[model samples]
Target chain A: GAGVSQSPRYKVAKRGQDVALRCDPISGHVSLFWYQQALGQGPEFLTYFQNEAQLDKSGLPSDRFFAERPEGSVSTLKIQRTQQEDSAVYLCASSLTGGLGNTIYFGEGSWLTVV
Target chain B: AQSVTQLDSHVSVSEGTPVLLRCNYSSSYSPSLFWYVQHPNKGLQLLLKYTSAATLVKGINGFEAEFKKSETSFHLTKPSAHMSDAAEYFCVVSEDTGGFKTIFGAGTRLFVKA
Candidate 1:
């Protein structure tokens, strides 16, 4: 693909429902990141992956949010028991290098609405 | 610890006039700074980055930022504003502190008036 591709551009979930968002990063990109962006706010870091290794998950808001990149190519972010506060855009980004100061390419993001 | 602060929540500029967006950062080590623009309903696009290489960095769309270590600021500037430049701008700081994490500011909304 030309850039990072995210699935389910928009999703509306009921309270207590579980929702999964998928992200396909650029070809052979070594680093993948997940972020949450609320309305009128900048994107906040959620998790990061270096290949198949889950090196960092410090930014995940709570235990209900889980992200995995098992094969190191595609990643999924699953949220359990969605709350109204969870309604926001989830963005996926990828970078060629796994270090500070590296440029990251972002996807269009998946807009999630919890009713 | 490293963080970024965007001074203004909103800035309005007339087309063809100069644009200035203020940003300040705090870092314990040499930091890498970036400016990203996000249009309505669109993904963020990198405008420019300032590493340790050069103090002045030029980015896409006639946008540029200067790194001032003494002031702890990396303010974005453009000679002339355009209507198409209306968007949200974010200031980001990255440092290899606890881990490789990128911190984003609250973001400033730029409104260009024709």
Candidate 2:
């Protein structure tokens, strides 16, 4: 794809249910990132991957949230036992290289509504 | 740590008026700064970025920002506001922590009144 692509653009998950959001980054990109944005707020970092390696998971809110880019291209973010507070937009971004001064491309994002 | 602060939560300007969005940042190292805009229900788009090369950076849609090391500020500005410019703007600071870890400010919602 020419840009980062995200699947399940919108989802409504019941409390205690699990949800998975998928992201396909730009081809040959070496870095991928996940962010969570609540209503009227800026996106907050969730995790980061350098190719297949999960280099940073410091921003994940809890153990219930998990992300993986097993093949260094496609990634998935899973929220287990979703709660009401989990409602937000999950954004995926990728950069050509993880190096300094690289521009990161963003996807449209997955809107999750926990009911 | 690195952090960004957007001074205003909301800013209103009449169409054709000048626009200014203030941003301040704190970083332990020389930071890479960026400005991103988000339209309603749309993904974020990069407006501009400030690398080490230039203190004044030009961006798309007639937007520009100046990085002032002494002030620790990277403020976005436009000579005139367009109706299409109404959107949310975020200030971001990226630091190298093995890889770049970007931190975003709370965002400023710009409203252009006709």
Say which candidate scores most in DockQ. Answer: 1
DockQ of each: 0.80, 0.75
Chain A TM-score per model, please list them: 0.98, 0.99
TM-score of chain B of 1: 0.98
lDDT by residue for model 1 (B1-114), tens: 888999999999999999999999999899999999999988999999988998999999999999999999999999999999999999999887656788899999999988
Give model 2's docking category: medium
Clash numbers, per candidate: 0, 0
In order of appearance, the predictions have TM-scores of 0.98, 0.99
lDDT of 2 by residue, A13-94 (tens): 9999999999999999999999999998899999999999998999999999999999999999999999999999999999
- Model 2 regions more than 4 Å off: none
Clashing pairs in 2: none
Candidate 1 lDDT tens digits, A1-115: 8999998999999999999999999999999999999998999999999998888899999999999999999999999999999999999999998877889999999999999
lDDT, candidate 1, residue B70? 95
List CA RMSD, all candidates.
0.8, 0.7
lDDT of candidates 1 onward, in order = 0.95, 0.95
Misplaced by over 4 Å in model 1 are none
Prediction 2 global C-alpha lDDT: 0.95
